[model samples]
Target: MTEEPVGTLAGIARHAFPKAPMEVLDHVDVSVEAGLAGDFRGAVKPGGRGRRQVTLIERGDWEAAMAELGHAIPWQERRANLLIDGLDLPQVAGTLIGIGAQVVLEITVECDPCSRMETIATGLKAALTPDWRGGACSRVRRGGRIALGDDVVILDPLQGQLL
Candidate 1:
C-alpha cells in the first residue's frame, strides 16, 4: 500500500558483446525484450524471458566496498546496468523496482561477485560479498526511455526488504 521513493538512477551502461568495453549512456531505451538498447545480453535473449536482463548496484554499497578496499574503483567495473543511490537495494528476489516513469524491473537474483572482481583488487570480491553489495539481476517488466537522475521507487517492498 505504501510506495517508497527509494532512490534515483545515477548511471547507465551497456556492452556490445562479451568482454566488450562498457559504454556509458546519458539516456537509454529500456525494453522488456532487449533490456537496454544495444546491450549484448538483449541480443542473446530476444524473447525477453531472461531473468538477468538488467543489473543494478547501489552507489552507497559500492562506495563502502571501495572504502574497505582502500581504492577508488569506478562502479562500471562492477558491470551492472544501472547505478542507484539513496537506500539499500533488497537482497531477496521478486521485488519490483519502478524507474523514471515507465520502466519496471523484477528482481530475480543476487548479482554475486564474480572472480573477475578479484582482478580489480585483492579483496574486492570479499568486500562485495556480504550483503548484496555486488548488486542484483532482474527482468524488465515495462519499457521506457530513461536518463540519469530519473526517480526510482520501490513498488513491491513487501516482497523483500534489505537484508
Candidate 2:
C-alpha cells in the first residue's frame, strides 16, 4: 500500500483552570496516565480517566473557522492541547493519531464547541460547529514528550499500521 502523509505538531498549550486562558508552551510531557504534564486537566481529571485526556486541532481548520466568523482569532482561544499542521484531523470517532516519537492518541469524539466559545466571540460557537472545526477529543494511548516541530503520524487501527 502507498505510504500515508505525515504531519507536524505546530504548537502546544495548556491551562490551569477550566475557564482560564491557555498558556502556550514549547514542549509538554504526555503519558498514558498523566496526559499532559502540568495541565489542569491532568491534575484534576487524570489520564485514562476521561475521553478528553488530550485535545487536538488543525491549524488550517482553525483559520478556516475564524474566516467563516469574519475575524482572526488566536488558536488558544479554541482551548486545544495541540495544534497540528498539514493533516486533516479525522472527525470520525476512534481515529488514532501518533504525535512525535511517542504519544499515540485515539480520537474519541468531536469536541463540540461550548458556551465558552460563544463568550470568546459572538458567533464563535456556530462558526466552530461545521466541519468539526471545534477540533477533537482524544485519549492518550502511548505517552511521551511532544514538542514543537514533532512529526505527526496517522495510525490505521484496522490494519495495525502507522501512516
Candidate 3:
C-alpha cells in the first residue's frame, strides 16, 4: 500500500488526555496573546471555574517523539503531537494553527515535570530525562472539536515565511 505523503511538517502523533478528548472541541482557537502553563493559583484542573491547569512538555517525552523526529535529535520535549519545529514559541503558545480542517493548538508554556512520569514511562527516566529538560505546555485557545488524521499546517513557522 502507498503511504500518504505528509506535507511540509510531519504530523507524528495525535493525543488527548483521558479526561479531555479531542472530540470535546469543535474547533481549536489559539490566542496569539495571554496564555500561561505553569503552576499558579488559577492553573489546576479540579479547581474552580476561573482557573485551569497548566500543561507540560518534557525534553525526551514520548508525546514529543510521536510528533516528529526529523530534526533536533530526539529530546523528550520533541515528542509533542503538534511539533511546531524550529519555532521559538516562548511568547506564542496561546495561538492557533488551522490543521487541514481542524485547529491544532499551540497554547501551552514550559513547565518542568517531576518524578511522576517515571512511573508512567516504566523506569525510563534516564533515557527520558534529556527530553523532559526542555518542557512544554498548552491552553485551550478555543475548545470545540479535534481528532486523529487531522492534518497540521503551521500558520507561521519560527523562520518567518517559507521560501
Candidate 4:
C-alpha cells in the first residue's frame, strides 16, 4: 500500500526584493541554482544552492504565536517562503524535507526572527521564538515545481533517500 503523506504544502510565497512584502502564490518554481522563483534572495545571493534557500513555517506554530500576541496578523507577515501543516519540523540539522515527488531540502538551521519581526508587532520576534516557532532554514537539494496542496514528507537520510 502507498504510504500516506505526512502533511501538505499549505502556502507558497515569494518576494520581489529584500524587506519587501511577500507575494503569495498558488504555485511556484523551485530551482537548485535559484531557490524560489521571484524571490530576490535566490537571485541576489552570491552563489547558487546553499543554506537559506527556502524558509518554511508550521501553520499551527504561526497561529499559536499570533494567539499569544493577541494579534490576528496574516501568516505572510512571517516572511516565510512556504507554510506547511500537520508535521512538526525537526530541529536536527541535516533532516530532509521532501516536497511533492521531486524537490528536496536539507534542513540547515533555525530561521531566527529578525528585528523586523518586532516592527510588525511588539514581541512578535519573541513570540516566534521558544521551540523554533521562527521556522526552518534549508538548502534546496533537488528542484522542481511546487504548488499548494503538494505532498510534504520528512525523509530519513540514512535510508539512501538523499536523492
lDDT of every predicted structure (CA atoms): 0.85, 0.85, 0.36, 0.88
Q: Which 10 consecutive residues of model 4 have the lowest summed lDDT?
A: 41-50
Backbone clashes in model 1, listed as residue pairs = none
List runs of model 1 lying over 4 Å from the truth.
1-3, 44-48, 157-163
lDDT of 4: 0.88
Clashing residue pairs in candidate 2 (N, C-alpha, C atoms within 3 angstroms): none
Across 66-156, the per-residue lDDT of candidate 3 in tens digits comes to: 3333233332223333333323334345443444453344544554445554443444344444533344555433333333345534344
Candidate 2 local distance difference test against the native:
0.85
**Candidate topping lDDT:** 4
Worst 10 residues of 3 by lDDT: 30-39
Q: Each prediction's TM-score against the native?
A: 0.89, 0.91, 0.38, 0.92
| Total clashes for model 3 | 39
Runs off by more than 4 Å, candidate 2: 1-3, 43-49, 158-160
Cα error, residue 106 of model 4, in Å, equals: 0.8
lDDT per residue, candidate 1, 101-132, as tens digits?
A: 88888899999999898987999999998888
In candidate 2, where is summed lDDT lowest over 10 consecutive residues?
41-50
Angstrom error at residue 129, model 3: 3.6
The TM-score that candidate 4 achieves is 0.92
